[model samples]
Structures are given as structure tokens and as C-alpha cells.
Target: MDSISSRIEKVNPSLTLAVTNQAKAMAARGEEVYGLAGGEPELDTPDHIKAAAIVALQEGRTKYTASGGIPELREGLAAKLAADNDLEYEPKQICVTAGAKMACFNAILAVVEEGDEVIIPSPYWVSYPEMVRLAGGTPVIVDTLESDGWKMTPEQFEAAMTPATKMVILNSPSNPTGAVYSEEELRAIGEVALYEDIVILSDEIYEKLVYGETKHVSIASLSQELYDLTITVNGFSKAYSMTGWRLGYTAAPPAIAEAIIKIQSHSVSNATTFAQFGGVAALEGDQTFITDMREEYDGRRQFMLARLQAIHNVRVVEPKGAFYFFVRTGDIGLKSQNLCDKLLSRYKVAAIPGVAFGYDDGIRLSYCTTLDILNEGLTRFEQFCREH
Candidate 1:
């Protein structure tokens, strides 16, 4: 056999995706799998957004757009950013990409060179370390304590920074744990960024999915310097139920925006042109659809957190925002992957292991499924805990 590319060979596959495939294969065999492996919203995209896409296609908006994005999208997105996040950005400063994932990739690719370091908090998103490795940068993981709601502190932020540290990734209403940083917490981190001249890659993809009285705060909104150093990455996937549309954008500094556009042109060129039109409507049209979905998800988030608490050994912190319950199942004493495997093969419930998120001892339960399915799955989970 021929040798593979060294860069590809050096990186591990996405751990979340591995569990997703395992669940999918099980479902293919006619298993009644109540899967919660993927973080995607299960709700359908609202009809209004789809209607806009159809209208765009009919208007011959199917052709290639400017490499960054169409002017209309950039304008709409610029307005959405200012109105929603309280940060002002011009159309040229915004670059619409394939998804938040790709936008982050482009940002990292643009800024980091070989031997650069990216600081990520532990129980971090599985993609962070892998992406850094693929970009020829090292990921320095800072462990946030469970007592602190799995959030990094300002001291830790300062300690993690070195001359080689080029970027720091922040995920609010975070994945895996669903923890949200308070405004104060963000300001503290922002201060560190101000001191170090380090870049902040704020992944606010789950921004709008926050629950209860909590709200999403863009670090850029905290101060002017934060606004300059921060690259606000977001998309319609979770909020607008537009995961299938593959639309996301980055609100970055002018220089970074130009670099990202260069990378975009050489790779994806432009995201689906029709989807960009849908995005314009998503930003401009009835936001009530997003609000309604958040309400439904909030109910499920509360319900799922309560149910998990009932299991004797599992300790779960109620997520402030986002629809995930990352549980600390101390009594089972099994690796999260092994437990996830057992839970799926026996109970037909597919929760992902926390090892993927750098928490080897826990498991992540995505509560994005129907409430009835969640109840049924929780029952099976309780029974599993009892037996094991």
C-alpha cells in the first residue's frame, strides 16, 4: 500500500462523529436507537427560511457570489451582528463561510503557523484539538474544575498564554457541558486578551439556545479592545434549525476577514448561494421561530436535567444554556466510552462518551430528541445504572 499524507495520518478522527456513526449503524439494523450523539438541533427548518431560498433560486441567485459572500448577505449579517451582539461591523469585515466549523478552520489557518499554540478549556469541544493539530498548531488544554461549572478562570487564562499562544477558543453555552459564562466571566477573560494581544475565537454557535433567565453575551460587546481581538463565529444551525443549510459566518477584524476570504476562495469558494438567501431571511424575518424553538428546548433541558439527577451515582449540573446534560456517573466506574457502548448495545440509547470532550470519566447526553423519547431513554438509563 502507498503511504498516506503525514498530516492526515497524524490527526485522529472526530470522536463525536465516531459515536454518531456507531449509532447510525445500529439504527440501520432496525434497532430502536434513541441517539443523542450529535449536537445538531432535531427540529425542522422553519418554512419561511425555506421559502426565501426558493425565491432566490427563481431570481437567478444560483450563480457564484463574491468570494467572501454576496453583498446582500454581508449587509444583513452586519446588521444582525450589530443588533444582536451589540458590535458594529461593516459588510466587508464579515465573511460568510460553509459553517461555523469552517469559519473557525479558516481563522486558525489564517492566523496560526507551525508551532503556534491554541489554548482550549478541558471538556473542550472535540474538534478544537484536532483542528489545531491539522493546522500545524499545538492545542494547550486548560482544565476547568467542576466546581466552577467547567469554565476557565482569568488566572488560568493568563497562565496558559505564552509567546507561542496565538489564539484562544471560547464556547459559550458550551457543547458537551452546556455551560454559559456570565458577563463578568467574559470581561475577566477579555482583560487577559487585552494584556496579551492574543486572538479570541469566540464560538457562539449555541448563543441563542440558552435556557431560563440566562442570555448570550458576545465578548466583543464587553469592550472596544475585545471587539477588536475577538472573532465572533456563529451560524443558523442550532438557533434557526438550519443545520442542513450549511450557513455560518465570522465577524472578524478587517485583516483577518481578508485572509479568511482568501482561504475560502481557494477551498469552498462560496457556501451554497441559495442558503445565503435563506440566511438573509433568517436574520431579517420573523425571529419568533427561533424564540419558539428555544422555549421548547428549555422545557426539555429542565426535564432531562431532573431525570438524570434521579440516577443514584450520576451528578449533573443543570446547563445554563444549550441542550446537553454532561453527567458525572461516578458509581459505574467504567470508562465513558465503555459505558456509552454498553448503554447503546443493550438499552438502544446512544449518548456520547465524554472522552471526546477531554472528560474521560463522564458522558454527554444531548437532549435534542423528543420529550417522549427522552423519558423512555431515561427509564432505560436508570435501569442500566441499577443493574451495573
Candidate 2:
């Protein structure tokens, strides 16, 4: 009898994790490796948030409250949506999940059906397409251009739609590219969605990591039509340095939110109880820590950009937000995977290939690590470019 499910037969391992793990293995063997593949903040979780979690643990808030989340966290998330994003979602319209990734997955699974088409822009986070596949949906990959700063134009989005189209994924301060979409651009895309009557999944997990003059806009906030059709996903991982806490939330229409909760209850139940308390604290507590982290990240982004710009033929679009630089590698006569492999094995620097993110001719390097590691990795990157 055949054993394994075909559900996962074609799924690829996470390229970012694969590269990071290989670098770790090499380092374990005493190789001097600079791992720049993963997008995790180097900062520790803020002490105040940790104290909130500790207080929760001490009070024995260890059991599951609701599949959506504890009422306090949900209320905090609701207030956050209203205050920060200018989108009003009642507590009932929100569902907390293990992480923003899981929230995204839940949204996809809740709405997408077999043979339904999900329009994913090129250079997307690797998980978007995979999550669509897991939901038995067809991923309609639309290519965005470097000349356009890697954003999907309204025309491109409209061109990709069909009667079968169910949803589209948009990430601002996009992973791997750090391309922050302007409000004008998002409104244009939202207009397309409103005209086509397609659902939009707006992933704004990196909403707070933007650089100078780059504002993060929630498409749902632009109009009620977009809000009705949008499911906004966010988490504490990027902004709060709480990646290990596995706390995230989705704000959708009431029906969609309930559907997500139904699916979540049957599967993962709720996010960790104490972690949800921390999430509440993250939202309701003092936010000065976020400004500090953003400032530090801006500094690193500037350093990384300058260094990469110095490398000949390695053109990079200035990333306005997030912590990644997608360096165009077409000038080097090698496929992205091959280029990445060579960089890791020969130079001991780990970066993810752009092919993993549905783009070729580039590779994504994360600047979320320390300045010393970034300097070392970039130095190796320049040497490798010169040799090639």
C-alpha cells in the first residue's frame, strides 16, 4: 500500500531555511560562514513584553481560551487595526493563529477551493504559492518587473484575472524585495479587485519596518469595498522580535473570520496562551522599542545598499522597507541556484536564490543579522563577483 499523501509530494523545502541550515552545518564543522538567508530580527524580544508573558504564566493562564484568541488580545488587535491601519474590525472579525504564516494559510484554505486560481505576484514570499497549492488551488503567478520596483501594476493584475480567479496576495515592504507599495498603487490595485470582485489577501507583517518617507498603507483602509473583499494578515514576529512566540492575527469579514476559526479549531486550536498575553502587551504597551529597532534596521539597510551598489553589475532597486535586498545577478553567467550554491560553499556566505521566490536573475540577502556578519558576507559577495 502507498503510504504518504500526495498533498505534499510536490512541495519544495523552504529555500531560506535550507540555505540557513546548510550554513549552520558548515559553521558547526568549523567553517567561517555568514548566514544572511533568514529574515529574523537580531534584537531580543522587548523586556516589557516578556514581563507580560511572565505575568500571564505566573497567573496560570496556560489553558486555551478561544480558538480565535483570548478576548483581551483580540480586543487589542481590534484597537490596533482601527488606530494604526484605519481599518475597523470588531473583535469578532479577528482570528488569532499560530503565526502570520498560519493566518495566511488559514485564509487561503478557508476561501480557496480545488481548481480555484490565486494570483500571486512574482518575487513573492516562498510560502504564498505553496500555501495555495496546499489548499488545492492553482497558483496564477504574475510577473512584476524590476523597472517598476517589482510591484504588480493594476493592468498586470487585471490581465491575470479570469472567471476562476478566487484571490490575490499582496505583500507590502515585501519579503525578499522590501518593496513598499504606495497608497496610490494599492488603491489602484484595490480598484481592480473591486471591479473584478476578487478577494485580496494583504500581508502586512512588516508594516512597521519602513524606511524614510515610505509609509505602509493597508489597502482595506482605502475604501469599504476593498475592506469587504480583503483579509488583512499581520503578526508580532517582525515588529516585536517575537518570531519564536508564534503569534499572529487576521482581520477579515465576519463570515471569513468565523471560517478561519472553524478550520483552526479543528487543526492547531489556538496560539500559545502566554504568547497571546505578550501580543496584547505588544499592542497596548509602550511602542518606543519599535522605533529603536526601525532606526537600527534603517542604518543596516543603508550600509547593505551602499556595499551592494559598489559591486559592479549587481544592480539593486533601493528597498524602502523590510530587511532584504534582492540583488539582480543576471550579469553573472549562472543560474540563481547555482550562484547561491557557489557563494555558500566557496565563500561561506548564505543567501537565498531568487528562483525560490519565483524570480530568476537574482538572489535575496537578508540584512537582519548584525553589522559585522553583514560586512563579512558582503565582502565575500564582492570577492565572488570579482572572481566570477
Candidate 3:
């Protein structure tokens, strides 16, 4: 066989998906498994959103859309940004893509190049560094501490910058860690990016999943200069439980948006046609589903937090947003992967290793499943810790 491209070789398969699939396969074999590795909600897509897609399909709305997306969806997204996120964007400055993952990749490929550097914090979403590598850019990972709530500070951002630094990726309500940046923290970090003229790829896909007094803020909304340098990516997968719909969009400055559109034109062409209609319904229809989902997740988050805190060898920070607990398992004297491997094989509980998120001594346990499952999984997890 011919050699694969070197660029492709540098990327790793998503570990979160790997763990989820393995757990699913085990369940399919009729083995009992408690799954806590997936990042998606267990809820079904709302009826209104599904009905809109069905109507579109019946009307033969399967034709290809403009590479940027259908006009109505983009307009709806612009309005969504203005109303929900406090960021102003025109429809012309938006590009819809297959998923939020694609939106992030497209934005990275549009601006990143060989020898350029992109800053990512530790315990980030696993794909961020890999995407940068695929774009031929170097990923400079800065490690954030548990003491600071696992958040990157403005000083840390400034210290990580260099002449080759081209961009910084921020995921508020971050994956793995579930750390939500406050408005003040975002303004301080935005100032650093503004002064350095570095582009910010702000992934707010979990924008609606925050709990308690926690709030999601778009760095782009902090100021016009920050807005001009930001590519704000969001989608319906998490908020509306439309993961299978494969719809996401980016709101960027005109030049960056044009670049992303050109990239989409040559690549996926556009997001699925009928799916865009579902996206429009997701934006314009009743929003009560989001609030209900958030409340349910908040309950689960509390349940898991209290349970994990009671375990002897485990340490966890209370996640203010998102449905995950990035627990410290290093105290048990095992690397994350080995611990996770044993947990899945012996305890029949699946969880993602923290090494995948750039932290080797921890593991990410998601609360997206039911309380019964979480109770069983954590019970087994506690037994495993005690034995170790």
C-alpha cells in the first residue's frame, strides 16, 4: 500500500468516541455495562425540530444549499447570536457546516498554516490539538492548575504567545473539565488576544448546558476588537439533543467567514439540506426544552458530585457547567489509561482517561446518563479505587 500523507498520520482517533463505542459494543453482547464516557445527552430530539425536518423532506428540500448554508438558517443563526450570546453578526458573516467539529476544523484550516502555533490549554477537548496538527500548525499546550478551577489565566495566555503564535482556542464550559469562564476572565483573556493580534477560535457548543449561577459568555461579545478576531462556533447537538442531525455553524469576521465558506465549498459543500431546516426550527421555535434539559442535568450533576466527593481515593472539583466530573485518580497510584482499562474490564464501567485531554493523572466521568446508571458506575468505580 502507498504511504499515507504525513499530516494524516499526526492525528489521533477521538478517545471519547473510542470509549463510548467499546461500551456500546459490550452492551450489544448482552453484558452489563454502565456507560459514562459519551459527551452527548441521552434525550431525543425535540418533536418540533423533527417535524420541521420531516416537512422539508416531504417537500423535497434535499437539494444542495449554498456552500455557506441556506439564507434562512444563517439569518436565524445571526439572530440567535445577537439575542442569546450578545454578539452581533450579520448573516453574510456566518458559515454553516456539518457539525460543530467541522466548524472548528474549518476555522482552523482557514487560518492556520505550517510553522504557525495555536495555543490550547490542558484538559482541553481532545480534538483541538489534533486538528491543529492536521492544519499543519503546531499546538502549544499550556497546563492549567486544579487550584485555579482548571482555567487559563490572562498571564498564562500572554506568556504562551510568541512571534509564531497565530491563534488560541477557547472552550467555555470546557470538555473533560467542565470549567466555565466568567465574563471578567473572558475580558482579560480577550484583551491579551486583542493586543497580540491572535485569532480566537471560541467553541461554545455547550453554551446552554451551564448550571447554578454559572453563565456562558462569548469572548467575541466582550468588545469589537475581540469580536473581529473571533470565530464563534455553536450547534444544536448538545442543546437540542440533535446529535444525529449533523448541523453546526460559525459566526466569524467577514474575511475569516469567507475563508471558511471557500473551504466548505471545496470540502463538505454544505451541511445536510433538510437538516438545516431542523436547525432553523431549533433556533426559532419554543426554547422551553433547553431550560428543562438544563434543570435535569443540574440535578444529575449534584448527585454525581456528592457521590464522587464521598469516595476515599478520588478528588473532584465541582463542575459549574456541562455534565462531567474530571476527577483526580492519581492518588490511587495508577496512570489514567491503565486505571480506565481495569475499570472497564473488571468493574464493567466505562470512562474516558484524562490523558486524552492532556492530563495523565485524572479521568473524565460524564453525567449524561441516568441516575441509576451513574449510581452503579460510581459504586463500581469506588470499589475499584479501594482495591487499588
Clash number by candidate, in order? 0, 0, 0
How far off is residue 374 in model 1, in Å? Answer: 0.6
User: Residue by residue across 40-158, what tens digits does model 2's lDDT show?
Assistant: 89899999899999999999999987999999999989999988999999998999999999999999999999999999999999999999988999999999999999999999999
Model 3: lDDT of residue 57 = 98
TM-score to native of every candidate shown = 0.97, 0.98, 0.99
Each candidate: RMSD to true structure? 1.2, 0.9, 0.9
lDDT of each: 0.89, 0.93, 0.93
User: How should the candidates be ordered by lDDT, best one leading?
Assistant: 3, 2, 1
lDDT of 3: 0.93
lDDT of 3 by residue, 273-387 (tens): 9999999999989999999999999999999999899898889999988789999998999999898999999999999999999999999999999889998998999889889
Per-residue alpha-carbon lDDT of model 1 for 151-201, expressed as tens digits?
999999999899999999999979888999999999999999889888999
Please list the residue runs of candidate 1 whose C-alpha ends up more than 4 Å from where it truly belongs after superposition: none
Instruction: In model 1, state the lDDT of residue 191.
Output: 91
